[model samples]
Target: MNKSLITNLVAALLLVAGVLLNNTLLSLVGLFALSGGLTNWLAIHMLFEKVPGLVGSGVIPAQFEAFKNAIKTLMMEQFFTQANIDRFVSGQDSQVHLHLQPVIEKVDLSPSFDKLVDVIMNSSFGSMLSMFGGASALTPLKEPFVLNMKQSLIELTQQESFIELLKNQIDQPNVMAEIRAKSKKLLMPG
Candidate 1:
C-alpha cells in the first residue's frame, strides 16, 4: 500500500530472482535497495513513533510541551520585544497627531497668572501697580487671562508644526525607551 512496503516487496522479489537465476548484479542491487529503503522508512517513522531500545525516537509527540515552550521563547526574545514593537510603530508612514487640547483646557492657569502678578509686583512696576489699587486691578483680568492662556495653548498644540515636532521627539530612541520603561512599570507594578 505504502511506498516503503512496496519498495521492500520489490527488493525482496529481486533478491529471490537473483538467487534463482544466479545473477550477482541483481543481488547487489536488491540488497542496496532494501537497505536504503528500510533505513529511510525507519528514520521517518522514528520522528513520530517510539521504538524499543531507541534513545531519541518519537520526539515530536513525546516532547510537545518543550517544543511549544521553545517556540514561545524564540518569539518573545527575538520578535515581540519592546524595541521591536517601538520600531514597528515608528516606522509607519502616516502622521502621528497628539490631541492635547482636552488636557490643556483642563489645566489651571490661575497660578501662572498669580506668578506673573507677583513678578510684576517684585519688579520696579510694583510702585506703579500700588497706585492703581495694588494687585486688585488685575483681578478683573484673571478670568480673561486664564481663558486666553488656555486657548493659546490649545491652538499651539493643534498646530501641524508642533505635532510634527512632538512626533519627532517621541520617535527618538531614548524617548521611546523611556516611554516603554514607564509603561512597563505601570502595567507590571511590583
Candidate 2:
C-alpha cells in the first residue's frame, strides 16, 4: 500500500520476469528502479537518524545547538536590529498602532478620584467642594479623564524617544541573553 512498497514490488516482478525470459534490458531497468527507490528511502531516513557507515546522517538533532545559535543570530541581526525596529514603528502603513482602549475600559478610577477629593478637601477649595458633596462632584469627569489619559499614551508612543527606549531595552545585553536562553529552551526542551 505504501508507494515505496509498490515500487519495490514492481521492481521485484520485473527482475523475476527478466531473469526467467533472459531479458538483460528489463533486468537492468528493474535494478535501477530498485536502487533508486532504496537510495531515496535511505536518504530520508538518514535525515533524522544516524545510519552506520553513512556520513552526514542525523543532521537535525546532531547539529541542534548550531541550529539554535543560527536562529538566534538571524533574529537578532536581521529582525531585531534598531534600524529595522525604527522603520517598522515609524512606517507610513500604520502597521503598529498602540491601542489602550481595553486597558482604559478596565481601570477603576474611583480610588484616584477619592484621593483627589482628599487633596482638594485639604486645600483652600475644601469649603467649595463641601457644597458639591465632595468627590461625587467629580464623577462626571471620569470619562473625559480616562479618554485624555488614553490619548496622551497614544501620543507618547508616537514620539521618537519612545521608539529609542524600546530599541535600547531590546538591545540590552541582559535582555538579549534572556531571549537566547528562552529560545534554546524552546528548541531543546527536556
- Global lDDT of each model? 0.82, 0.74
lDDT of 2 by residue, 1-190 (tens): 8989899889988888888889999988888888888889888889889888889999988998899789867776776665555555455335664554466557776566567768888898988888988767877887777667666766776687876677666667676666656655664567
Off by over 4 Å in 2: 1-45, 127-190
**On residues 1-190, what C-alpha lDDT tens digit does candidate 1 reach at each position?**
8878998999988888888889999988888888898899999899889998898999989998788778766765686577675665564535534579899988999999999999988999999999999888889989999999999999998887887787777778787777766655554456
Model 2, position 40: C-alpha lDDT score: 91
Q: What TM-score goes with each of the models?
A: 0.52, 0.48
In candidate 2, which residue pairs get closer than 3 Å at backbone N, Cα or C atoms, i.e. clash? none
Give the range where candidate 1 is weakest over 10 consecutive residues by summed lDDT.
88-97
lDDT comparing candidate 1 with the true structure: 0.82
Cα shift from native, residue 50, model 2 (Å): 2.6
- Report lDDT (Cα) of residue 97, candidate 2: 49
* Best candidate according to lDDT: 1
